[model samples]
Structure formats: structure tokens, C-alpha cells
Target: MTPTLNGPPAPPADTRCDRIDRLRAALNRALRGKPGVVEYVLAGLLARGHLLLEDLPGLGKTTLAKAVAAAVGGTFARVQCTPDLLPGDITGFSVFNQKTREFEFQPGPVFAEVLLADEVNRTTPRTQSALLEAMAERQATVDNVRHPLAPTFFVIATQNPVEHHGTYPLPEAQLDRFALKLSVGYPDRADELDLLAGAIGDVSDARAGAPVLAPGDLADLQGRVARVAVQPNVRAYLVDLGRATRAHAGVTLGLSPRGLLIWQRVAQAWAFLKGRPFVTPDDVQEVARPVLGVRLGLAPDAARFVLDQILAGVPVPV
Candidate 1:
């Protein structure tokens, strides 16, 4: 059974002053044995940006989103992206009333605290725009009506890279909006063995992933994340790192200013998760792949090359 969040059984092991550890426990419990994945996901959330997970089918992408949503204690919604989907299908339209002479705003699936957009690329570009708007701005403007989103609105959108028959590659602008993109690759031999042997009952339900922390807790966490210090040299190093992606001859597009901002936030979040108040070269090195790798790659090995170039040329910003 899921533990109730309304009242505490006792004082926390440590989060009375800081809640990152508590939040991590909640995610790790649901994501069991994938703490790195948990860190990457939380980094995006800490940065207050969206995430994209591209991998083969059945890597538990939906479950990951749901689990993370539960850990943060937010309302989660999943949208199965299909070819026939419409804008109204996602951002809900206002239908005119002849008698009343006014239209009412009908919210679609985008108004939740967390949204899992499954098979995101399967839908046409038009349909994808609805999500892109929410992912980028944290609000959806339909018929010139702007609807504010939840303070903790987060999107975990995924696509199957192996299958391209009906898929649409997310455009560069759209890809730029995601703070980070990751792959939930096939689980290691151990996790897979546990996965195969584990019963369905082992999976935690939405309510099971219930809020261990409240919205204010998240606000406090992000505030603490922002304060997780990055040294001047490290800031220079991060800039040089992102600049290198754009300057790479093979890269058609470079990481944007927005990407630079989000990645800096990501680096700080990463450091904070490790229980460090100050960021180090290791923090930058540890997160470069997940935060900037996929978003700035050229070809199959493009992203890896970008990281290599930065590491070799930048000398860790110290």
C-alpha cells in the first residue's frame, strides 16, 4: 500500500531542512535500481523544463514518467499520440454557443501537473504543436485564450527510434525546447531479471506514487537547486561546452541560449542531488551527456563526439 502524505509517521531521515534527498527516495523507490535515470529526470524537473526519451519499445518509459510524477506528488496525465489526433484533441477548443453567444474553454489533457506523451512522434507535426506549446511556454493559448498551467507542469514525451514508418522527427525548434533528452535503454541483466520475475503487483499505482512532498516543497527544492553553486570557471566551462556544439562543423544546428540556460540549471540540480552545495568539474562531466548530448548531436555518434571535443579542449574549466 502507498504511504499517506497527509501526516508523517516520524521526522524524516534528513529532509527537514532540504528535501532533495526525500524526493530522491520517492523516485528511487518507484524506479528501483536506476538512480542515474532518476537523477537525469529530476535534473530536468529541477530546471523547470521538459524531457524527451527516445528508445526502443517497452523500456518502461510510461512507467518512468508516472513514477516520477508520483514521487513529486502531482496530478499525472498520459496522452497516446496517434496519427489522427487533432489540436483540439490536446489543447481543447472553445465551441460557440448560438443561444448563449459565448464559448466555453474545455481543457484537454495538457492541464495536469505531469503529462506523459506516449509515441509522441507518431502524431503529425500539427498535433505535436499542441504539446510543443505547453512544453515550451508552460501555458497553452487556444483561440487567443491563454490558459495557465500548473506550477509544476512537466512533460515526459517519448518516441520509438527503431521504428520510423509512421513517425515524425521532432523539428529542431521543438527539440530545442526540451531541457534534456535521454534513452531508457534496455535494463541491465540484473534489472531485467528482476523485471521478468517481479509480479504486476510490484508496480506502484498513481496514488501509490502519491505526493511525498507538496508544491511548496518543490518550490523550496528548486530554490535550493538554484543556490547549488557553480564556480566562475565552471560557468565559463559550461559556456565553452555549449558553444563548441554550435561551432562543430558536423552540427547543422547549435545549442541555443535557452539550452545554455537550462543546462546550467541542470548542472546545478545534478550537484545538489549529490548532496553538494557547490558544483565541480565532475558534476559538469557527469551531466554533459544526458543534458547536452542528445540535444546537440550531429549524426549517430555526433553527440558523443561533441562531448569529447569539449572535454579535450576545455580542460574542465578549472
Candidate 2:
């Protein structure tokens, strides 16, 4: 059963589909050659989950984050992380106001609907931990007082995987908060040429389409996604696959129970994006790389091998 909200009524199915198509087309125009990547990112967004982008610099990661924020018409904020950053900087602190004779709570970048933490690895562990509460609880604690963030708080963090100097690796606990980890690699030759040709213009083309779904609509859609059907067999398959990861010799840490739940939600979101009410094994497989890659922590080559083995070993429900 979908939870009913007192807010505005949800648009009809056809209307929603039309809006999604328009949004997708707009993103395609902006990204030029990354249809698959666009779909993956959309899945995470619809799932109401955080994302981590581990790629080299100048790969359009920041651009993708900004474009997503624009597409949703949400408040966008960015934090350029550095080793010297403090937790209070990301989560604003209270300052004493002389006129009011009290302290005023100041909201930080984490208060926005969409927050882009660029080069998250560049920050110290303490500063990185500042996102833990906000990412998990959708609230921030400043001076022991809680501040609620936007209803649709989504984080898109990017870090350079190849860079080790001046970088602090994200803790396992922090990494687990991200539902998916992705990479926006370089564009192909033709796409690169096209980008160069249009280099003189602004990124406004990405934000061309008006918001198709508002915060209320997103909340309702997420509720509907939660109701997406998964067969008993498929559920069993997920459990079995999770167990396999735990039993794998190469993996030091396996997917936790929370991780499993997040994996299922992402699959459900992917199905919803495809206009399906039921999830399929293919849906799970499609999102496996990003979901599993972040948690597995295997070498790139080894992670691919392990993921392939797990997927192959699991029996797909008929």
C-alpha cells in the first residue's frame, strides 16, 4: 500500500512517464553520450539514496551533480573539501547574537536538497564524518540542537580514485552510506568533438527542462517504489547472493543487512524507472556494479571477477 500524503495529488502514470521522458531527453542533450550513466544516476536519485562518484578529475562529475540538482529544481550547495576543513564548516554552528541575546542556528551546505561534496577524499576523516548523521538521519546536530534538512536531501560526492596524496580514504562506515558508487569516465571521440564544438555555451542546456517532479511528487513516488513487488524467489536469490559475497575469499567485508536493503531499493527504483511494477533479476544485475563496488572494496579487476562470479552463481527466478 502506498502511503498517502496530504500534499498535492500525484500526476497520472502517463503524465509521470511524459515528464520522465522530457527530463531524460534534456539530460541526454546535456551529457551528449552517456545514456547508461544517466539512467544509473536517475535510479539512485529515485531510490532516495546517496551516491559516490570515484573517478579522475575533469570527467564531468561536478557537471553531472549540478545538472541533477537543476533537473530536480532543488536547492543546490557544494563543498570543496580540503584537509583543513572542519565538521562545523559543513554543518553550520550556532553563533551568539548580541541583538537577540541568544545564539542563532546557521544552516550549512548540508541543508540543501542537493549537496555536491567535491573530492570528498581530500577532507580529513573528522570532516568527512560530518555527513554521517545528515546522510542517515536527514538531520544535523549543532550545539546539541537538531536541525531538519530538506525532505529530499540527496548527496552526490565525488573523489579522485587515482590520487593518493593529500587524500584521506573514506571509512567503511562512510562508504556504506552511499547506495551506489560510480565513475563518469571520459567521453568518446565523437562526443568529445561535439562538446568542444559547443564549448562556448553555458551548461544551461542541462537545466533547460523545467522540473518534472517536485519534492512532494518525489516523496510519493518513493513510497510507490517501496511498494514495488519482488517475488519470493527473487528475495531468496538476493539473500543467496549476499551470502556468497560474505563467503567469498577475496572480500574482507561483505554487504551488511542495511546494504542488502539498499540494494533491493535501488533495484526497485530501476524497475520503476522502466515503468514496471515488479522487479527482475536483470534489474538487479543492471545496478549491481555501482551498488556492490562501493561495499566490496576489491581491486578493480578483482571486483569485476567477483561480481561476475556471484551473478553467475545465483539462479535467476523464473
Top candidate by lDDT? 2
Tens digits of per-residue lDDT for model 2, 1-318: 232242333323542376577667766766669998888888888788999998888777777777777777787899999989899999998889999999998889999898999999999999999999999999999988899998779999999878799799999999999999988788899999988887666655443345656667667667767767776777788888899899988889998998999899999888888887677888888898899999888877899999999899878878
Looking at model 2, residue 115 earns an lDDT score of 95
Where in model 2 is the C-alpha error above 4 Å? 1-16, 201-210
lDDT of each: 0.76, 0.83
- Estimate candidate 2's RMSD in Å: 3.9
Residue 281 lDDT in model 2? 87
TM-score attained by model 1: 0.87
Who wins the TM-score comparison?
Answer: 2
Q: Which 10-residue span in candidate 2 carries the lowest summed lDDT?
A: 1-10
- Model 1 lowest lDDT segment of ten: 1-10
Q: Residue 121 of model 1: what lDDT? A: 91
